[model samples]
Target chain A: MATMMNSTVFGTVVPHKNPTILRPLPCSLEELFCGKVKNYTHEKKIYDSSGKTFTVHKSTLQIYLKPGWKAGTKITFPKEGDVIPNIEPADLEIVIEEEPHPLFMRENNNLILRKNISLLQALVGFSFSVPYLDGSEFAVDVESLTFPLTPKVVQGKGYLSQRDGSAGNLVIFFNILWPKVLTEEQKSILKKGPLSECEYLGLL
Target chain B: MATMMNSTVFGTVVPHKNPTILRPLPCSLEELFCGKVKNYTHEKKIYDSSGKTFTVHKSTLQIYLKPGWKAGTKITFPKEGDVIPNIEPADLEIVIEEEPHPLFMRENNNLILRKNISLLQALVGFSFSVPYLDGSEFAVDVESLTFPLTPKVVQGKGYLSQRDGSAGNLVIFFNILWPKVLTEEQKSILKKGPLSECEYLGLL
Candidate 1:
């Protein structure tokens, strides 16, 4: 009888709004498992933290993205690990580490984006479009709004909550951009209209 | 500021002799995240321990897979998780669960297989071919062998070890098959040849 053990590996994949996700593996690695890969040589150049570089030779392997595969995804290759002399080889596992997105922020299946709008737009109404995590564009219409600090929400437009089958809402927060320098005419115009209420409150 | 939390999900990938690994996600899941998928509703049917079936439609999601995920793989769908009212969605992690292989067994980074041979072959000499994990054929030769219990080994033909970045060996064990019944003519033939040495032993 042979003792069974497992080996784990980590990997990362960034998901776009599209349904399909793609991951590439070294050709040498594929050859290591598949024995051969036609005519191609598997090789990769990598650098360490100290800027030391090395070359790795392996066949290329591609992992097709499936549903339920997201950041922190872990997969195991049974009996695909090391050899212990007379015993059996262990299992191999692959873990994933997703790179952070630039435009969107996540919070428990909810998507958030911070947008900047002119003071006039914040005071009146604003309409804009933002990209969803899935790569789709969503138009946000802010109606009957006077404050920019409050966030606008679109129901069923956020992330898909794995916990509940429903989609979360997409929230857009507006940051009112105030003029860095105001001309006398602009100040007078502001004071006569939007600023009139502040003046009346004696808090301007 | 949004509180950052990571949701870990486990998945499974069966390792073949090929380099590519594949995983599939449900179409409903994609629709749930994308906010629209035509007229089909997103509903999951699940069976409980008591053998009761139920339909779930709350948008709450849970991924269930036996065993555990390996290391070295990551998938991140930004803001594709829970909705915290006004906050962003949490990150979703899918851990992998590797299915076991049928023919070969593992131990660390080594691969093992067992084979059976006739008693005549065990006593004289035998040669055969076996499939490597990577789908390659390797010939094993046994010469000057009297015992049938010993194993044959191929160096550096096992699994790749992550600790040392080297491959292990492939092990083959032999099992001697015995005849259920012996005919008088066969017995006499055996007694005149290979059995001649036993006659020198007083115990025989």
Candidate 2:
């Protein structure tokens, strides 16, 4: 069978150098899902050996974002290139830049978020809610005796994969926060309690 | 001082899959040098699991080409891309595909052409004209005892480099073509002659 010709090019949407959040600034999740259009301007200057400058090309451009687009997702445009004389104008490829998200790290299609919890919660059990990429909140339940630095996974809650268009899991890593100082009474209580193993090692 | 934003997005003007010539078909060197605008159309389709296909997007676009544009040259279009929400639209980048030319080959900014010459021309001297990229013709002189498969260079007759904008040289390779058969009279006339070292080898 004859193959179809590719009429569009791919490009990356890069994130800012210092991104403060996982999502784009001033944009809501709903806006990203529904797609958005923006106006942009670009300029260049050519300098000679004598430092004489020439304004080469400058103009404003329109950037389009489709619904469900994310970092590393290629945005394509049709017939947005040079004229091929008699044939057709080539397509433009926009490779979405794989910029690091400030609050969330990406692995394949999965999203990773790290959170700190109290020592008590790590020993017993805890329940909490985290913000999903879609702006909705999802609850995370850590079972009793859940170890600090361990990861708990919430399946099917991650960024959409551009390769297969499937969603991935959201992994949460727990960091235990220990009290910096203990009162005399608290230290005495711990010493007489069931922490004898630690007391023998002078950790009490 | 604040830095200036890039307003122009660079894209490649890809060569044809089977490029017969350097310039695109139906395009003259004059037209390429003067710049031209041509109409183009693009289409795409979406298919379901049941093989139900639907046309997604179709549009006619205007493709612009500037003068002195060649294969591997980047063309820029200002403000031609998707619009970002509240922010400016992103610029589109076109990457020209490096395709093989049937008659001429490219290396960096230089051009290469190979031609075949008669055995007599390789032993004696010969001269000929070769076509330049800019539609001009230049003469090439081969000195006596020119070796086969050796290249003769013509300076300042190559593509303009996008980096430095300086021109390069054109290199020509010679291929010697031997006569298929010799008649008896021709063979006898050469047998009784005063033979040089090479002539003795030929006779043997």
Candidate 3:
């Protein structure tokens, strides 16, 4: 009987499985970067050993999301979807959805934070404290004048990929806040010529 | 002999043609809507009756651009590209490129002109003279409160489509000029309640 298991005529055949049903599991960028475990309770189907009788049952699914798990990543469960009496059960899949973070945006494994400063501060140098996921803050200084769209990037400070254990970059996007109106007194001070060429170009 | 022209052996075989070379012809949106004729003086390779030698010659290509021509629209000249010995000439194509206008942007057949107004003007409504390409002006009144990205569209004021002989539309994009700093006295005036609901939402 054990040797006959290798023969196709004696082997037991499995029925065709139904399609997959994907459910979105939304997570913030911080939660995905640090890793999290979430649970969902839903109605499931249970079948008898003979596959002739079925009943609805409540099931709790616990999902562990690793660090750097991007949106659209799927966690699948075999035959956990709708179960019919005659048809095969469908596969249940949970897809990761990245919700918009208040301060940070995730691109691949990298993180981007947009900061706006006055045009005067942009031409001159400015420094500000940047917050980390662990509630810690560090000063990121701009020694040189910064321009729009030319981000200041620090390597290996972004999310860590669990797939290959690779760390990504942290990007700081600076936006120049131009003055809506300038007084004649302020204009005279700028014309006295103490600022760099960047200031002149920005004002013009 | 006339019947033999249908046979495969008697049929004239055309040599393999080369790829197309596209040249950009940049034009202003106004020029495209009104129509213009422009000429280009370029060097052309002149091949004699035999497919053995070629000589360089100066040729002038005069192109008549039809009204309402959009960017990326192409005009083709068959076998007008490089002429090499024993090699078929490539097709020369002229692609239309829309230059940035001082006042307007084109989307489909519609023209969009962006205007900035004070926040108070946005809530209270305002009117201004909109300029036309022919140096004419008309008053456009905004009776209700306005928001960003919701433009005022006027039908049949846009670029004309030569393909279908249909007229386009004109769109006015309004941008709210929010005050950078509100005076204490001005804040009290608003708090006394005279502005519309749009102003409150904008401030918030």
Candidate 4:
């Protein structure tokens, strides 16, 4: 024998939630290289206590950005947008957008730097230094002859991954500056040298 | 005043049509450079005269591919797929896919060819020749010292536009081969000459 139980249930129908329009949050390379927390304050409509009336409410969304966050990174804040009569409140989406850097260009996780150097620097050794995105300077002593537009790779110097906490390589490209003309004496010296495949001097 | 008219209308309810799944058509660079016609034979179910029974029908789709057509190019055939009860047939979509070439690579409207040359050939003059995608050969009599990985652009030599009858450029890049060791005499000869910016000889 079982006893009879009565359960009364009442529920409100929920209309489809409104879609969120992407809002761009532009950040400089410096801010992307260093982690930061940003806060946004805006006004949105919310339901009053009577549930039929609407009132404006001020809300704030806090975003914690990690290092090396890239453009198109989306963060969704639930129920933070305006509320309509019978529909659920829309979500607020904040996407990260990068501004072009003065020194470095990012590809995936690698950082590329392009520079023009004199022919002397390409033949002999040269000291290379540049201020990094984090406002820190780095230097490399290049002992070998550099080729034009050839990348000199430095290990573990680029963007640090926010997910894996790992770093990528930094690539440096040098463009050679060729002299317009040579003197008579210079031409004679060049005409006298390296008869065979020895013209690529240093390696030979 | 216009004459009053009585028009009887007979209409049928239209159901939602089926969606199409894209079918990829692989093409060689040669075939893409030279226009070709491709035919595909397939079997599909269609309604019989009673409009209630299914019948298997064999059909063919002819594709006319033009020159310079790139990957992801789509061609749609209306109502060429299987038919179900009470709905229009799905459309057939054919997408172009590029096959890797043994000699040349395509970039937009341009063709790129990479080659490796000896150091002697780079210092002196060299003759360059390669078979193009259209089975035609091209030659260049390089009179200057060819720098490593420098590109020689030949205008109006690549893909011909099917729409406007225009053509693109052919870019040739050369990589230099360096000698592993040099004789003592060769090293001395290099050390004595070119103290100034005369090393980039022909230009300087």
Q: Pick the candidate with the highest TM-score.
A: 4
Per-residue alpha-carbon lDDT of model 2 for A96-196, expressed as tens digits? 44445556776766778887765445444579888665668878887544453458888877656557777778888876554333444444443343222
Compute each candidate's TM-score over C-alphas.
Answer: 0.34, 0.33, 0.50, 0.51
TM-score-best of 1 and 2: 1
Instruction: Indicate the TM-score of model 4.
Output: 0.51
Candidate 2 lDDT for residue B179? 37
Docking class of 4: incorrect
Give one digit per residue, the lDDT tens place, for model 3 in A1-204.
Answer: 001112134476555556688899998887798888988776766666666566888888998988888999999988887566545667889999999988999888898988876544444456899998646888888856565567999888898876789999999997655444434444433333232111122121
Best by the DockQ measure:
4
Q: Residue A36's C-alpha lDDT in candidate 2? A: 72
Local error of candidate 3 at residue B33 (angstroms): 14
Q: Which ten residues in a row have the lowest lDDT in candidate 1 chain B?
A: B195-204
Candidate 3 versus the native: TM-score? 0.50
- Chain B TM-score of model 3, please? 0.78
What lDDT score belongs to each candidate, Candidate 1 first?
A: 0.45, 0.50, 0.70, 0.72
Off-target runs (Cα >4 Å) in candidate 4 are A1-12, A41-43, A46-60, A193-204, B1-204
Runs in model 2 lying further than 4 Å from the true structure: A1-70, A78-91, A98-102, A194-204, B1-204
* Candidate 1 Cα RMSD (Å): 44.9
Give per-residue CA lDDT, model 1, range A32-97, as digits (tens): 211332232233333333334434545543344332234554454444433233224344444444
